[model samples]
Target: MRDDVRRLLASYEPARQQPDPPLPPAGVLLLLHDRPGGPHVIFQKRTDRVRDHKGQISFPGGVMDPGDPDVRYTALRETHEEIGVRPDDVDVLGELDQMVTVSNFLVTPFVGWLDRYPYEWRFSSEEVAYLLEVPLSHLRDPRNLVPDRRIINGREYVFQAYRFGDDLIWGATARMLGNFLDLLSALE
Candidate 1:
């Protein structure tokens, strides 16, 4: 499975990101299940009680813990700690390129596979209020992802928007997801 995913991503064009100055922190992307039609990625809505990225839909991860040996460890550990998904249940396919968040964190996205749908999630109430599943196929639709334009000092730029059900998954997570979808589309 890892070999197949590697081949898929390898055959596709990679995402283009600018060289970052310095990293503020790190993050994770937990790619859970891939059924017949397409895969599914998990998202957690950060509760307002959290100090950072509160009330936003994000992956089940946070800043690298001091005891973490690396970002990979941080991802798995945080996923388990935040959402009760054990690292043992995850088969890490590989990693997407590191992405720099607007908040200045250097987010390293780890791609992995989750075996089954029937499992339990223990949410960190202070951090996660709820969990949601996004069909990977949804991200492939260009129309589904709208662009928001902004101009500062007579310069213009655009950010991608992902409308999923009633939830708007945007910001760094959307960018990462967009990049991942672009890769999958290229494979197709």
Candidate 2:
């Protein structure tokens, strides 16, 4: 898997050429760890009390702080603050293309590996409701991926969603996950 990640990074191409300006920069960490059966990625269900995207399943990350040295550091710092994953513990494989969300955030997604297994996670009560560990194999299944459509202000919009139990991973998080999955699948 490490070799596959390296290969994907080495053959990297930017799908999103230019990000819209005036959007606040944000970073997200796609942290994968080895579980019993296979590699699993961690996600957090945001608390309903939070301001934005409440109750949504998301990666452990947030908007960049002024103190952050760089986008990768922002991701690492946010992950540490949100889920207690130290920056030193992560082995950064590479990054995905920059993505701009409807909420006016230019998100840079970073892919990282824990290198060790069976992680013990502690969640921040102010932000996260609970932690979700999903097997990569489950996401690889075609049946689990579905097209999500909805009408907002009489305009129809569609996006990709991956279902795990009753939870739906959609929006930006889904986009990042889909990209990661695509990268892995390309190696097959």
Candidate 3:
């Protein structure tokens, strides 16, 4: 499966979009680790102290800094800052298509692989509330895809999301996850 992921990513051409006026660039790491049952993906529950996406479940990442060389670097840097995984520690598989967030940021999702489990994780309490290590099998189950409805300014919005216990993965993150899962499904 790991080899399949690497090969698939190597040949994949991610779709790109250039919106008018341009949105600020952000990067996120879809960190995957090999676990007992199967593979597990890492997600961080954001603290309410953060400015954007507060109390939301997301991959470890943030906006690109001026000094960062590239979007990939931004993802790695943010991952290291949010969690303790160093850039060198991750075997970066590749990237998925760019996603535009409701917060007006162009986010690039980079997939990375870790060799083992029970990794020494040091997370930022100021930004991260907790970490969730979700198994791929659970995520792949169609039953987990739950419909979410919200009302904003007298308008009803329906969204497709994944439900893991008390957490709801939706919006751009869910879209990105859906894309990643589609690729994995293609391999099977």
Candidate 4:
């Protein structure tokens, strides 16, 4: 099962070439676990002080550092730093499709499984504003799932959504989640 999950997430990152304009590096985690109901994932709200995506609900990840070994290492390390979960605690299954954000960042999403829930979490007041351990069932709810259309640089774009409470998980985060659901649906 763990190996399977890893494979699914890994499918998201394709080895592609960006000729003239190279993409900025970023990464995130798509964590999952089968509980009494079904699978679940985690989310966090960025602090208003953060330079980008402030006060918006997001995954616990960030831009890759030069010191990181690879993109996978970047995702694992960022999640641990933001959520206070050590890298060993998360068994990375695979990765999700890479996404291009409006901010021009090319983010790599990784999937992980955690059986033992961590007791406590600490956040950087400068980066994380709120935390949510959202269940996969809740995200799968059609009511919360909505469509979002936009015109970026005169090009029309459509994205999916997962609204949790007052926060709207749309844009890159939501698109990534939507991709996850699409993959899970295929397995069913």
Q: Give the whole-model CA lDDT for all candidates, comma-separated.
A: 0.76, 0.88, 0.93, 0.78
**lDDT, ranked from best to worst:** 3, 2, 4, 1
lDDT of 1 by residue, 51-118 (tens): 77878888887788777889888888888888888888988766776777766677888777886766
Least accurate stretch of 10 residues (summed lDDT) in model 2? 14-23
User: Which residue pairs in candidate 1 collide?
Assistant: none
The TM-score between candidate 3 and the true structure equals 0.97
TM-score of each: 0.84, 0.94, 0.97, 0.86
Residue 22's C-alpha lDDT in candidate 2?
62
Q: Give the Cα RMSD of candidate 1.
A: 3.0
lDDT (tens digit, per residue) of candidate 2 on 1-188: 87688668768984653654567789999998887898898999999988889999999988999998888999999999988888899999899988898677888999999867766677799999998899998999999999989788999999899999999999989999998898888878
Error of 3 at 112 (Å): 0.6
Candidate 4 stretches with Cα past 4 Å from truth are: 1-4, 7-19, 34-36, 149-158
lDDT of 3: 0.93
- Scored against the true structure, residue 118 in model 1 reaches a CA lDDT of 64
**Root-mean-square deviation of every model:** 3.0, 1.4, 1.0, 2.6
Q: Give the TM-score of candidate 2.
A: 0.94
| Local accuracy of candidate 3 as per-residue lDDT tens digits, 140-178 | 999999998989789999988999999999888889999
The residue ranges of model 1 lying beyond 4 angstroms of the native Cα positions read 1-3, 9-21, 35-37, 149-157
| Model 1 worst lDDT window (10 residues) | 11-20
